[model samples]
Target: MASSKKSVFAAFTTMEIVLMAMLATANAVMTTYISPINQALNTLGGPIATSSITGIYMIYGLLAYYIIRKPGTAVITYGIGGVVQAFMGTAYGIASCFVAAACYMVIAELVFAIVRYRKWNLGVLMIAGGAMVPIWFFFAANMFHYTKWGTSILLIALGVRIVSGILLCGLLTQVLGSALIRTQLLRRFAISRGQGA
Candidate 1:
């Protein structure tokens, strides 16, 4: 009788850990620059800034998940990135980014778990990206409650964020992931090893 081969990458390798750390740290540094730009846009009457920044914030998880495809990768990457950003003293405060990253990953991880992590197509990406909206609102409402922003403005912001998440994080990630797959740079990962499915 022939025995089936156990998956070679059931556990993360050192290279994978290094890749995760590099990506997470890069994400944290990017946040330091992106957040101020977002605030500036908001001041200039650019309400869509929320959507843009959220999408940008979400890219790290999307990229990390795409490359790693391991369970809990999103949570770990986002958690580390968030902590790093908070410690770096982003304008939004450490607690805000920390909570935001935690919530975003929770929603994303739940969707991935339900799908058994099999589907990495556009539709699934869209769902995963869009799922962060509720968490965004939860955190935003808490932070902005003292600002006394009207319901109409809040609704507009939510709408913008949803659309942005779908486009920037969902569709864009799919496109970028496809590109990455084509470049053969991800050959070391399971997605290139025919084990992603």
Candidate 2:
């Protein structure tokens, strides 16, 4: 187990899988309840409820990184969220939902691949956050019929996603992770000795 922990292939146990399922379910419910507003907000922010929650998605990847820290753990988290969101979100029978989600998985996986599955490092975290790049360009642009945002516009959007991901996932989720470690629920993943603040 210890050897596995250091590898990027570390997988979530049954309990952690169930726990992520629960968290995804909860987030989806909240997302659905706010669908109308979320829709409008997404439009205002650009499209597809991105940038804002892009970090939230990164947080999931970071969680998986903490546990598995492997080559595919980050990818799996993206897929898990996609499936869970589909199960819980309105989706409205729109094909765009599936396409956008798949795009997210692909792009996020690329970011993790570039970082070689290290999420604790700031550069890796930034790369993970930057994974939203193609999602906005390819998915939102082509699949959703969005107006062609120029390179400058795209950079700004990417910046929002990266910052959001770093703040929410890298920082906030780190707090949650630290707490869990103190409780010993996550000692296998966390190396620190003190009870996390």
Candidate 3:
């Protein structure tokens, strides 16, 4: 077998980096402002209404990773978002939340790594979504110690994450990616692999 070398990022530009950072910061702000909405959901106390925070993070993470197509983009995006929250001051003191966010961010990155940057199929997208996110389920289970949900139930929740992610994040990100391609920003690379110029 011949030895081969590979790169991780999908030829990201400086502008892309800054935009991803801005989106991450915006995610942090949303998390902070949505605190009340989460509380309200928790008060509802049902399977359909348990949590919302982590899902928001996943939405932004998907967008960042999709656009940047780098190994650690998700981590940086999620980390910076959490940092913004920390700056704003959180009930959990931001440090703990940041640590937790980092853990989940790594998970999201791993899913993308397994698929490689070029594979943007719905199945892969869904897998990434389920692997990393699932706000309304796991967090509630942990905080409330609700163990009534079985593995099958968990899988169902995971399925929802996957589907939702594909519909919202994956599709939207692909649109953005296509727009970038149309502008020729990605032509230097995308042209080689894609059919038309």
Candidate 4:
């Protein structure tokens, strides 16, 4: 058991850790910059508009996972992003940021685990990305009282979020990862070293 824990920890080298931290920081900043867009969407179409772009907010961790191809990549990336967002002052409040991060981490980790962390195809990545949505949506519904919005509206909002997850998060991650691989900049990472490219 101890050796197993050590191996998991050892899977993340110094470079991977640094890269994950950088990605997390970037995610925090980008999320902040996009708040105005989210607000505008909320104003125009309520939560559904905001939901449409939900995948954009979630890309950081997924991107990191795509590159790293490890068990705890999403957990570390999302965890650091949550901490950074909490420190940087998100519109969603510190607690909510952590809750959202935890939500993303749980499903991402679960999806990877189900595949035994071996698959890195577009379908699997999309499953991981799209899966990250609903749990958080459930929490958000209760937190923001979306249950009062009626079943149809709630279902619509959830559908939008799930599609956003599939397209914006999963599809975008694969696209970005491929681009990065082509640049040869990520040659040091698992993605470039393995089947990901």
| Per-residue alpha-carbon lDDT of candidate 4 for residues 1-197, written as tens digits (9 for 90 to 100) | 79755543456889999999999999899998999999999999987788899999899999999998878898999999999999999887788888999999999989987876668999998988899999999998887789998999999999999999999999999999999999999988879977432
Model 3 poorest 10 in a row by lDDT: 1-10
Model 4 residue 143 lDDT score:
79
- Per-residue alpha-carbon lDDT of candidate 1 for residues 1-197, written as tens digits (9 for 90 to 100): 12222343266778777777788889888877777778788887666554555677787787777777777788888888887787778776667877888887898889888887767777888888878777867676888572366777777778778777787888888788778889988888866765444
How would you encode candidate 3's per-residue C-alpha lDDT over 76-167 as one tens digit per residue? 77777777778877755655567656756877777776665556555565567656655434664575455676766666555655555555
TM-score of each: 0.87, 0.66, 0.67, 0.93
Q: lDDT for every model?
A: 0.75, 0.57, 0.61, 0.89
Question: Candidate 1: minimum summed lDDT over ten consecutive residues — where?
Answer: 1-10
Candidate 1: regions farther than 4 A off: 1-9, 46-48, 194-197
When 1 and 4 are scored with TM-score, the better candidate is: 4
Q: 153 in model 2: Cα distance from truth in Å?
A: 5.1
Worst 10-residue stretch by lDDT in candidate 4?
3-12
How would you order the candidates by lDDT, starting with the best? Answer: 4, 1, 3, 2
Residue 128 lDDT in candidate 4: 83
| Candidate 2 per-residue C-alpha lDDT over 1-197 given as tens digits, one digit per residue, 9 for 90 to 100 | 67644553555677656655655556556557656665677777664345566565446545555544445554556566667677665654445445645665576567667655544555555555555545544655555444466666666766666667667666665577557767876554432422111
Error of 1 at 177 (Å): 1.7
lDDT for model 4 comes to: 0.89
